[model samples]
Target: MSTPAVRIADLLEDVPTASNPPAPLPAPDPGEAPRTGGSTLNITVVWGDLTEVAADLHVTGHYQSVVPAAAELALDQAISGGSRLIIKEHTKLGWIDAQLGEVTYFPCKAGPVRSAAVVGMGPMGTLTERRALQMYASLLGEAVALGHVESMATVLIGSGTGNLAVSQAARALVRGFAGVLALLSPPTPPPRLTEVLIVEVDRLRAEQLHLALITAAESLPQLRIAPRLREESGGRLSAPSAAVYALAALARLAGPQSTPTRDGPAGTATRDGMPEGPDRPGREEALRTVLAGFDPDIQGKVREQLAHLATVDRTDLSLAVGGSVGEYDDSAQVRMSVLSGVGGLRWAALTGRATVPERLVPVDMDLLRELVNRLTEPSVEDARELPDLLSRVVVPPDFQRLLTDDARVLLELDRDTASVPWEFLAEIQHADGGRHDPLAIRTQLSRQLRTPYARVMTDALGDAPLRALVIGDPGDPEKGFQLEEARSEALAVAARLKNLGVEVSLFVGAANSREPGVDPARRLDVLRALLSGRHHIVHYCGHSDFDFSGTGRRSGWVFADGLLTAQELALLERPPLIVVANACYSALLGSATGLGRQAQPSGAADRSPWGNPQAALVPSLADEFLRLGVGHYIGAAWRIPDKQAISFAEQFYTYVFEGGPGEPAPTVGGGVRRARKGLYEQYAAGRVPPDIAPNPKRWSSWAAYQHYGDASDVLVRHDSSGTTGGS
Candidate 1:
């Protein structure tokens, strides 16, 4: 009986490489000049050979020697051996003169990880590195989904330059972890510039997660950002820098009307039917677009590259050395990876190999350089600072494992779980539990905060005497005061809070300053009242962006003139559900701007982040609410269809209050979620609904389906009354 690892290794050993050579020539070519003329002597020289011997045969173009890849030959031997594990002991060239010392014969059924193949930096190195990269990428999706593990790992897959690069290997590490964990988690990382993703790749930041990247690359970067960034998309990046650039490109393409494929590989050539961007500008049909501009020979889906790496054939090469053991001279070799070309035809190439006599070699130096540059192109990206928005990420079980292990602090609460941490945050302990009736007045703070309840409460509410708080657009008449109409909206919201058991008054047109930190003051006032045991709720609507430039005519809510970064928002204590009527157009438009910031993102070619609104409070509003303590926020990244917006809000409150007893609390965006179901119907009725059906014009965002606070924070469910639902 064999272990899963042995079984896996056996499967790995089955891979094939370059073609094998036919049996050694029975005799030399007649065209070959005899060595010392020592022939069989029985040779009745052919008419041409004897007649034209030396005159033409020796100097004649009668025969040509084809370059054979040594890497391919050794690879063939390993394949023939049929071992469970394959190891290639490559030099700086990733191979010996004969298959360049490539050895793939790991036959262990299962054992502690012990084998490795360190490829030097050269053509052979590059070949191995590319094979490894494609292999790692293909298995990544599955590895994450299923918490599988790989006992052995290999390394030095050409990050040292030459043909292979240390950075390129770094850029392709999906499966390397489980199948090759620790084995390749370089005890050290390469130069920061090696980060192919961002042009100005930050080495300082990525190095921190280099080791833990197997589990934390994408998640941790966003978490550690001290200042809130506008674009927080650190999606499933192979590396932090590449992820940054990939994100930048994704953002640029994520126009309000652009719908790029978020699920594809890093070098996913196209989106939907469109090319990655203007790089391959003419490709209009997304799916039909060719997969290579980076490397013409590169083909196959991400999945194929992965499988090919483990077991490829290489038998065409032949090596010959003529130098002394220690002080010898120049030698040459050839290598190739056999692959099927178009139309079920055969295709292969001399990846690299060293041979003696040098005559066996095939590729000219110039050709090898050309192939190397081409293969390395696509992975190289234009990166910059990644924003703090919630971008797409594939959080596999491995990612989960890393988080769980590193969090160091475990705290969970359920409808029935006991010992909630309500005592940590003060207001909850002393105040009359208002709208937040479901779980009792408890604060949800980071488990690490060491402050006593008294201190935290005093800090949050301040010494203000009284007055329930109300948050909403001031609706300044001078600024086109739609106060009367806006007042109606707030009043409606106030009514909803009351129905949720909030005992508070509604300041229909509350006047609070646009002063910086003013929110804390107003919120503190309400907190004081609640601590003294008053009940209250909150509601608001206006424009907002993650950054705050303070100059745009259509500026969203601004804390200060040019402040209000996302960090400030996320730091809010005990923030409540928030709703914004005039959210950014992208918020309403799902397909418009994939690039997060106001700046529109181009495709993969010239991915850039030239933020929009001419710096109008640059902070992306979506980022703010997301990071903020707001349990659930309702605001558009772009724009929402009017009817969709209205109905989204309407049914949201309806579900919360009227659903049923024991139902979950409703969230801010509950309405939108529900309304989306009827979107197509609404849109077909004259104007297409925003979120319902496909509307390439509108862009969906991380803000669209993302959630905060708790996973149990049900977006829509019946209320205790069993009729109205909750947000």
Candidate 2:
């Protein structure tokens, strides 16, 4: 028996191999006889095209469906000349509609690689690290079964348009390879595949894969991996250069239909005489043209915004506005930048102002607090103060200019401003000379808090059906904190989610006859359910408390026996993707001393620990969830009526999964906006029940809800089976 060897080699053209030596592997002992039964394996990471690699097998990923005529994959495009042959082979073998982790092999007569293996990675939206790992393991198992594979080459599977990070895919590949090797036992012959080559075309991603592979190898000493680096001409453009070329080509195509224009009103010809219509070029051309006009420094900032947008949704307008807390209690320094891509495009356009690091605009924190307080108040006088408060809120002119009627706004705010309901702010004027329409109704608005620990989860929820843990009225009625309508709300939400292909676990606090007088919302059970990491969403329709005297970490949802504090939730290693905290002040991140008085219960004021005059501003349940890496947290900034809360939840989920058979998935932000608009329209039509909202002049409960996550996040993705689930 001999030790396995692994090397990473950079295949630079005409470069001396001696300049970048491979890590030395231990020589076999002279006394040891050559083992003919189990073959020793060697692994290498190289920067080149998969088709050019000389190996027994070449592996690539394919979606569940057969490859279409117009392929979007880089590998498919690279091998376009032989793609027809591959497709024909696939059809002949009945390889259409493959399942995730399934692999099929076909001989290749046109490429350096003797044969190729195509592995199903499910749909584009459903590719995850787990699935990638499974696919890799299956590829090896199938290769071993063939018994002819001596060497193999593969692209880093799921790292391209499949939406996986390069490092993640690389790690998954390494782990999968190791897992197969570990399973080889006595009487079960080890795979004859000795050499494995990982090919990557993009220089940057290749470097990332190289590092990731080396790191993965270091963790598993049994693999005995050695690393080397080189670069060679693979006759393919790097990702950046390819992107630039594509954009240029698109611009040329778009030039004749609509010319690039200077600043002007949207949907109309600009001052530079460019026409705006349905026939105008896509967002790619518009973004490139707009970006080219900016100075290098500003362009860099705009590109940063674009990169941020790529993680969520790239087509929506992104407005990142935030500030550091100031020396004074009622004032803070603010800055803003707006990025947009009006149509389907990979790049983003700078629509508003670029952020000026040196020039921080001062904003009145008092005005923002006043706005939240006013919205919480149930008085006509307080509601009338909205226009004045909004005028004094210090929104940037650049941001104001970008606020069009049809804009899909992704608003990123700082902790100081997170509590302020920006959705209710009416920046755009109405056409009929009436009160301005709120941004929530006029535009699809979503919010993200600019926190240090917040992150966007790129991996899809695994192959399992989407799951939700719905908790309603978790507090006992004897505690004087029970929500009368919350149980029904939970049932309705669970039913709707189930209809949309989500596996829902519903828990209600009150004892029921069906359960033989047993309560389902046990604290231990709820905690275990949340920490299980199986559920994609956690919807709580009950009472929640915010600790103004503390840092808000102690604040939590009230349960049957105890409060499930934010401090406890922070311990979750795999937090749910979305959390809907439909409770009073669940999203409030400011001083709660003077807000939501009308909605508070009798003696609720006495329960507050606000006697401390030195109490500082605190984070909300939403803030804690985001900090712990929940992708989206929808919560109310103030007290919301039970009926309004139910209506909002139904509307939100309905819009989220509203897509028909083959339509594109709707965004989380879009759903929130539609839900809010539905409530506002109801109010406008005088359909509001007087008991739910007594005063027409008071700020509507619809505006109390705030979405703290990527507006572009699609919770449910449509599939070929006509069902929607978290992908």
Candidate 3:
């Protein structure tokens, strides 16, 4: 196969044979090979530009709207038909076709490469090395099945865009190749792919990557490995293109593998996202024990909230969002479990599909991320298409029927689904000619942060007038833009609390001479001291971090000195009743894997003494609060504007604390609900401030706020009246 500009055979024939061959493959020790006969895969690491690598297939990784310039430049020059501009245009337009991990292959017009495949890796914030490996393995399997790849090359997917270290990146690549080898086993003559070239940019890093691959190869005994370097640059490898390769070695380590069957036991469940093992212990006994330790009156109120949640006579459902790059499809798979006592402990696991549109593909996933992104931020022309977009997330028919009864369904969504604004979903069209948001009619929503400990909070919240640790503008002042509205927002909230007979400890940006030692330079120390006091609420009004550079499940406020991660939050002896992290991406969940990229508990095995601990399976700032034994948490699920956040918080606190003359104080969930409603009403009535109101669509930020815990819980005044309010 040859392109118009160059012949494939000639390109392969041009390179000379290596003077020294790579190390021979090692055989498994006796009794190490599995009795289940299956072939292995061969993997190799070489240092060179992807364009220069002589292989049948090329794999290129790309961020949402970004293409590697150097790689594109090489393709442009090698191809006869396109200019630099044309190649760039194609690259940009091509992304619309893939959400993530969907490979699009383009034939080379010039260069030595025969064909190039682009694998979309959504964004740096969400792309984990594990996910990269899965997608890469799937792509490899596809290429081999097509019977077209004799050899292939793949760029270090997340190394550049995702800020992954060379060793971490190489390890994922090696495992991905190994998985393909393991999966494509048997007497069926193996894939023609006999060589894999792991390509990187710089030689020093490449040498490091080679060492990592060699380390990985110790377990894989099917192929020899070698390192190839550029001859002209004194053993250095540099080319104006992305490098790619395939694994020739595969591993079939003989070991006992536990395969849990779908119908194995009453507590056992398939990988279909169903709840297993008679509910987490934290959900029942642990929580009950914690509640028992609370003061009598506070304990009574806390139990009342729990009882209210338990009053649901209808089905209880848990929705877990999952995705995979299937051998064919590229979309999300929604797994659900319905538990109902009405039918005597009946439970069922449901599977549903949600598709991604080609246009306006998801670049950054926040919540029902792929599904929600389509509806939340639409172009002007697509505004009228909102209802159609919402309809794409079709609830399974049986699930819909479950919602029809007045039992008040309890919907417990995992962090991913929690990010989606289910309140705005249009399940059906109305007679009035518009669809109603499903949340308006049915389902009581709350996030299942996976840890439950109501007892620890009841005592601290005992009849206390909400004492708040209010912080504004935690971002670095000298280097970062000022959050002008944050100070005002904090002051307004403090004033409101005071008016409602609550104690407020407000910390604005270092301008306050009244409070000594409370400057931006000692942000963390100041916060630790303040939190040491008896406070029921901690409201942060500033920027929050989404990127995690070092180890652990850590993300926090961007203080002037450094990041205020969950580790510091762990220092709090008594957790607050509620925490309001009002910042952009403050509520985003961490990795879905058991080890999250957010915060780890103090005593967890993964906790690193010197660095941030590996994030627990549920890694969100909100989750951190829950882990700290906080009762309730409210945070923005995605980026929010200053005015919207301020207005929402103001209204939310007002409803929670000082209610209108006739109305009773709103419950935590009720307060949040009304806040969203009030914000939406303000938008409709043209009452929102001009700076943020011109675009009605911006009001969607109201829907982005998420609650993580018992929504019925309320903050109570320490006064004899014991009035319950928002924290």
Number of the top lDDT candidate:
2
lDDT per residue for candidate 3 within 381-488, as digits (tens), equals 333345444534334434443332122223344333333445454444545776333442233344544334222322344564557778877554555535767766
- Candidate with more favorable, higher TM-score: 1 or 3: 3
If ranked by lDDT, best first, what sequence of candidates would result? 2, 3, 1
Q: Which ranges of candidate 1 are over 4 A from the true structure?
A: 1-470, 480-485, 510-537, 545-572, 577-619, 625-628, 639-644, 660-672, 678-680, 685-711, 715-727
lDDT of 2 by residue, 1-727 (tens): 0001111221231121321221121112212221222234567766666666677877776654323211223344344442124543343234544455666655445657567667765543444565566667677767776788888877776765355666677766766666666666457766677777777765445555777778766655445444563454573444344444344333333334433322344346632233343254465566667678689999777666554533331111223332221111111111122211122101111221122221133544444444555565335455444643564344544445445443355554554445455656666444675565565676666665555555333234554566789988776665465666777677778878888767788888644211233347877888888878878889988777554344223466766555677667766777787899777533322222223433445544323222211111123566677777777888865555666777888888876766333444565766787778777777777687655655553347667677766554556443446354442
Indicate the TM-score of model 1.
0.27
Q: Candidate 2: give the clashing pairs.
A: 6-226, 8-228, 10-229, 10-230, 10-231, 11-230, 11-231, 11-232, 12-231
Model 3, position 152, has a per-residue lDDT of 78
**Clash statistics: count for each candidate:** 141, 9, 33
TM-scores vs. true structure, each candidate: 0.27, 0.48, 0.43
Give the per-residue lDDT digits (tens) of candidate 1, residues 2-107: 0001122212322332311111111112223212211010101111111111110110000001211122222222332321113321211122322211222222
Please give the lDDT score for candidate 2.
0.55
The reply for model 2, stretches above 4 Å from the true place, is: 1-359, 364-367, 377-388, 428-434, 455-460, 510-519, 547-553, 586-619, 660-663, 693-699, 717-727
Where is the poorest 10-residue window by lDDT in model 2? 325-334
lDDT of each: 0.26, 0.55, 0.49
The TM-score-based order of candidates, best leading, equals 2, 3, 1
User: How many backbone overlaps does candidate 1 show?
Assistant: 141
